[model samples]
Target chain A: MAKATSSAPPAGSHAAAPINQSLTPDDKIGLYRLMSRIRRFEQVSLQHYQGGKMAGFLHLYIGQESVAVGTISLLGENDHVITAYRDHAHALAVGMGMDECMAELFGKATGCSKGKGGSMHYFEPSKNYWGGHGIVAGQTPLGLGLAYGLKFKKLKGAALCYLGDGAVNQGAFHESLNLAALWSLPVIYIIENNGYSMGTSQSRSSAYPSCLAERAAGYDMDWELFSGEDIYEVRARTQVAIERAHTLSRPAVLEIATYRWEGHSVADANKEKYRTKEEVERFKNEHDPIQRWKRVLIEEGIASEEDLKKIDKEAQKEAEASGDFAKASPYPTPESIFEDVYWEVDNKTDAGQTGRHFFND
Target chain B: MPRRLSYRHALREAFDEELARDPMVVLMGEEVAQYNGAYKVTEGLWDKWGDDRIVDTPISEAGFIGMGIGASMLGVRPVMELMFWSFYTVAWDQIVNNAAMVRYMSGGKINCPIVIRGPANGGTGVGATHSHTPENILANFPGMKCVCPSNAYDAKGLMKAAIRDNDPVMFMESTKLYGEEWDVPSNDELPDGELFIPLGVADVKREGSDITLIAHGRAVITCLKAAEILEAEHGISAEVVDIRTIRPLDEETILESVAKTHRAIYVEENKPFCGVGAQIAYMIQSTIFDELDAPVLRINSLDAPAIYSPPLEAIQLPTPEVVVEKALSIC
Candidate 1:
């Protein structure tokens, strides 16, 4: 069972992982830098949300950084990426511009989706990042559709659909998973099982709360589980799943066990209300992804402690500069209110001219 | 003048033309491929386009419909067929929240070029669950286009236009009119993309001077039959105006007709509560109150579930006799 209060072993203290210095020096540094960027992006955005400079619900991906960092790093330029509202990490991982992402959260014109999408609805079709969907499991079917499109067009591309533990209970989740498997769609579904569905724990939410991967058999798809806290493990398992989708044109499900350092959203102010401070502090000390990866980089001799801090400083500066860029950007104009509602209809003229109640001729 | 074809066949021809014209155009729905469609509209399409283009999916409305929207977002022109339009209720969020809002939310970065085609009517006695005319519901979305065709010609013409449109379109067809034959042009006459009819434009099916019968879909045909009764039996010339597209509604055509006739009666198969007629009736009375000879009357289906009994079903829905009687009541 996904016993939230069960006496489980400490996260990183499970076993002393054999340090693998197998990767080249540049690849090691590059992967580490990518994680740093994602980490800084979420940190800077969380700061803005807490300071009341930004609006709307801001869900931080502080702890479960490796799942996004690991999986997105393996995707090709032609592939599509879609995920839930906690998507600041996914957007940065998919190579979306930092300034534009910050602008989007800032609700500025220069944002990838202008000011319309806000933070939760960030869309960059150019980069094939569909959007940061607001509703739970809302993008599951959409992701299947993207896969179906690729299959229809005979394109060598697949869609990466990311979901959370909460989304597993939604009807669209089962419906989409079944259809994708039945149609032999080119898609990979990654479940970031961070154990909490907002405030309600998975123990209360799901029937088989402990095992999301076990349910994939009913849909006739092979499933796997990975440690989301371990970046390399996430990458290795995800690479296998992606290869299955790319080569065999089959859908695969991988559940990554992770944790959220903060509350579900920035609005969930009382983080200590549901989770104990000891539990949060223990994970931070034991298996924090950033600390683990940094340790690996140093002990493996790929980069020195001083060298890692220099890279971290660069990522922090870049994230802070993007915040400055967002603050400097302007809001969308009022005339743009009637724009983009329809494809060819001139909403400014057409809506103003018709589709309303007029008292007189 | 060119050739006669059934409304269903005309729709299939439009699909055939678009599929041949563009490689991105594909058809998908339940029973659309191996079963050749529930109504035979997609009878031989699977044989022609094969599985790659003509995809048959299991009954998962929310899944496949949303998938179609996603595919359309990525530059595929998907014509997704729902067996009954009432089934759209299952995928309400996908249609209204996702597909309809994606383009606007994306700030016009992506266009959902999709057409959700199916028979949306109540005359076939498919019971309340299966038989629902959801044009008003579909038209309610600002980002979505709603197209209802009354004849083979309009079916062919508007299907062409809807497939070519760069936005999500709800192509409403009538189950009662699928087998009805009309002067639908041959491929030679229409050529590639020649029979395209602009959405939101109304057609004056039968011209008159006394009273106007504003209707759409099957109601357009009912109004035409009612016009014959009014002219022959009641000695009244009733003009039948077909409000083809309901979303970007043709107010100019409606206003001009009501202004000339000075009397109008709105007709539709949907319930009177928030029906298409209600909107048009509001437009007519509000805009041209001085020009009206009487209140713009609305003749719609009785506010109840569609019955399985044919007699009860006919009684609940608007028919030619009901429309004629309403026209005489106003005049």
Candidate 2:
């Protein structure tokens, strides 16, 4: 019943349509600001982790900021979101204020998710960001469901699902993609292919390592593969996918070729174990997304070097303030443990649970 | 006056009522549309509600189950039917990691008001893969509500309650009791909310003073039958407590009964290892050790995978005879 379950996308003129430019200079600068914030956020996040101010695994979205900034810029008010554990950049790019995002990493009460969810699980419902799911490919079906909700409500919104290269091989990921296509769900699934799934490189993990989006043909989904080092490139490719989903209510897949500048997480310091130091240095020195975007901002005259530098300073300062805000915020009181387990009252009423309970001595 | 209905009819009536009551309610699962349902619990729903409401999904448990939870997050009340309880392992991450922890981890920002309902016991000759009493496993999570209805009346009332609940509920039903009829209160006979049984409540099916027989799901019937047998054969008037909700387990009813009767014998269709009865035994013993006349005994299914043979399954699952033996031994 899947209309496009072939490995090769259906032959069409839309596939050959030229990528065009719709971004104004102001908008390009605005995107630069967004990318800059994510850049500073990850940079500060690493500093905080190394300084022993942060606990747990921290997957730095250093070179992968464009994927979140580019994909999230296309989303609207009602469009929902789902992403894997590498979510600080996604959350910040989606307008979950810098303080709240950093405070979440610090486990503060003011943080989104009330500090209950750490780095791997930040959710801001006002922004319609579903969660920061930890399980590999676990969030795929949730995005499929969010799309189903939009379709069920007959609304003009869609769902944007973000995953990593390693997640494409998970059973839930394939199942969700197939169903999203078969049901004509309004969803755009973006893969942040940093070449590695944890310590295992995609070449070692996936049976097919060429382009993860090419696998979308098996599910009858429209697919695209593009380099994400350029913010314009990522934005141009994702806009087409987003529009197709909103207009035709179909599923699309985008695989962005990016690189992780750091080790697997804040916990991993041995960079020479799995990957070469020269390779990491090459990607960082030559193909950095922030540096590439900064050059564009200067060359296009969207902003002068001083304006760009001012924006950069402001983003870094904001990232610093987020750490202070988290440090000043309080933790959840111990007595509140029993709260929020259930709605506590009967449906839509203040009447407490009518079910009988034992008398605790 | 109350009307007679089978367990299947009671469940179908509940679904019809909820669907009519809430426009956001949608029922989706494998074979739920044209083929009715694998168990036919959702029969005729596809035609009445059409494709939008009653969706027949492809054979994908992880995808649809996760979708149900995700839809609930967006204010859609999804009542997903698992063909069998044993299939839940395939969607374990959705249930355990996402559905159960969404509210707690999200800091109560959003809740998944989804209901996952289906047959979840070992009497249908459905072999090892098909048969699993997963009340303990599901109830083990903190933010989950596991409801097991014993009879038709309880099934209808608890089904409505689970739907109305603003949290994720694991609504477990029985394949063997689908055709069994009971005196379920019809719509006109009951007042609004009278037929709605809230979760975390315990129901007393039969009252006695000599001993207490506690159980849940289809095992409640076995407990009642055993109570009758105990009364006639051994002059043991046994009280039967049906645990409607396993997680917010009604600790008061069991403790009160144990205190009054001074003897407790727990029964369950699940395996003995980490079974529902194990918790009941420990809780009762810890709370009322001085009140007990004898040790808190347990009668559970054989600690093995469900067998296909009727005779073997009969021996494997707890029976009236086993309940009687445990009751006598405890008394």
Candidate 3:
């Protein structure tokens, strides 16, 4: 049941309506800062990994920062957020400080998961951002369950679940979508269409690859596909989806057509062997979200070139400070291993202790 | 002062009592509503609670399971029925990823107080796909508790405990034991409002000093029958221990029995390779390596797919004869 909003345009208007009212200069500046924060964080993380400071498989959210920041900005703090392993940006966007996130990646004791979970499993319940799950499509049902919990508890909030194009292949994704649609769970399933799923393009992976929004019809769901490169478009489309999710108490799918600027993980080289350099250059020149937004900011007088430079420098400094803090953080002791596995009353007592004989000697 | 009740009746009573106690409780699954549940465990629930609470889902395992997860997350205490335990593979993601990992992943902010109940273990020749005991597969996951009750008493206690538990629980009900009757405490004697059988506690069915025989679910009955034969014919006093919960195993009970008996034998309906029996064996070997007079023995189903034929299935799964032989060998 699509509600007839008075502001909605007549049918077949491909051009998205402006966000009802123009964003103020401060709003624009905030969006820019958020995106830059994600960008700089990923860049610094990559540098740290390359310098042998951060271990494990690092999936950078470099070129796709706009999608996470733009979509997450529309959500409130109480709302739940779940995403796949490419999760540093989602964590930061959901109010997780940079220091703790970087510290987790560095495997420090002060990390969000107390260094138990590395890059792929950064959990921070304080912000309601569920940890980054390593298994693909594993978070879908959990997201639906979270939404179910919210509705069951009568909480005034929704759950936003983000997955990659590759995850759609998993059975859990389809199963969760069917259930969410049937139950009308307050969940928004965002498919970050970053062209490929760990090197396999969507065309080769999905039987129908034109747009994921079309797949929603099978589940009797309403969907929207938007230019993920455009922050304004991402924001407007996600806001509509989120609003629908809240009002209808149902799940909606939003396909964000974005691209990853680097390899899937830290291992692969961005040689464009499978794809042509021309294709990469085309996206870089035409669809670079940061550059496009930077141009918009300068032309719209939201900020000057000097102001943008200062913002970039501040973001870099913040990222560098986070790296320093993570580097200075202590490694988790052997005692920390037994803790947090189960929330037991005697966990502290068992800490720094040796095994005890249960029977008489 | 216990009364005799069938496993199915005991489960139904548990559901009735729990629903009457907590308004947050509901049930959903295939054939659970109009059909009164595939195994009739929810016989009179639909008429009592109506459709809103007793939901009948389509033949979509993944869908309804996921929906149940969602509802549980929303603070609904949902008891999802999988019809048959083997079909759990269809919704493995929901069970493993969401239900099992939610509390740990959320850093204890969220707890999935949901119970996924289904008929597990082989009996009545349900054939290969319908008769495989997949508790071992579920036991591999962390944060999820697995309970397999062997009789009416345990069925009621374990079901009530699972519903009240804060973590997600995989409650495996044996199809063969549904009609079996046993002595169970009446509802009035139960804990006020709701009752709980604490997780990770073992029940010693029969006490002896010669050897400790450990089993769970359908195998508990098998081990009991074997214990009867071991005592009467072979003149061996074997202690039978029922492992009600698999994950947080009752290590204290097991180790205590092993220390006294000086020998142990595990009986399971699944394959031997990395089965629940293997875990028990490893724990015993690690904790009580010096206490054993002889090597710990295990009687498990052969590592092969269950066949549709009766003889083949019998050969694949553990039988009373097989358990008795293993216990005697351990002695």
**For candidate 2, what is the DockQ-based docking class?**
medium
Full-model lDDT for every candidate: 0.84, 0.85, 0.80
Q: What is the TM-score of each candidate against the true structure?
A: 0.93, 0.95, 0.90
Off by over 4 Å in 1: A1-24, A346-361, B190-193
Supply candidate 1's per-residue lDDT for A291. Answer: 82
Per-residue lDDT tens digits of candidate 3, residues A117-172?
78988766667787598889877877887787777677767899999999988887
Candidate 2 pairs with clashing backbones: A4-A220, A5-A220, A6-A217, A358-B252
Model 3 segments more than 4 A misplaced: A1-22, A344-361, B66-75, B101-111, B190-195, B285-293, B329-331
Q: Chain A TM-scores, one per candidate?
A: 0.89, 0.90, 0.90
- For TM-score, the strongest prediction is 2
Q: In terms of TM-score, how similar is model 3 to the real structure?
A: 0.90
- Please state the Cα-based DockQ of model 2 relative to the true two-chain complex: 0.61
Which ten residues in a row are the worst by lDDT in model 1 chain B?
Answer: B185-194
Q: Write the per-residue lDDT of candidate 1 for residues B233-328, one digit (tens) a residue.
A: 989998889988887788889999999999999999988988888888988888899999998999998889999998898889888999888788
Off by over 4 Å in 2: A1-22, A345-361
Candidate 2 chain B minimal-lDDT segment of 10 residues: B186-195
Residues B295-321 of candidate 3 have per-residue lDDT tens digits of 988988787777778887777778878
Top candidate on DockQ is 2
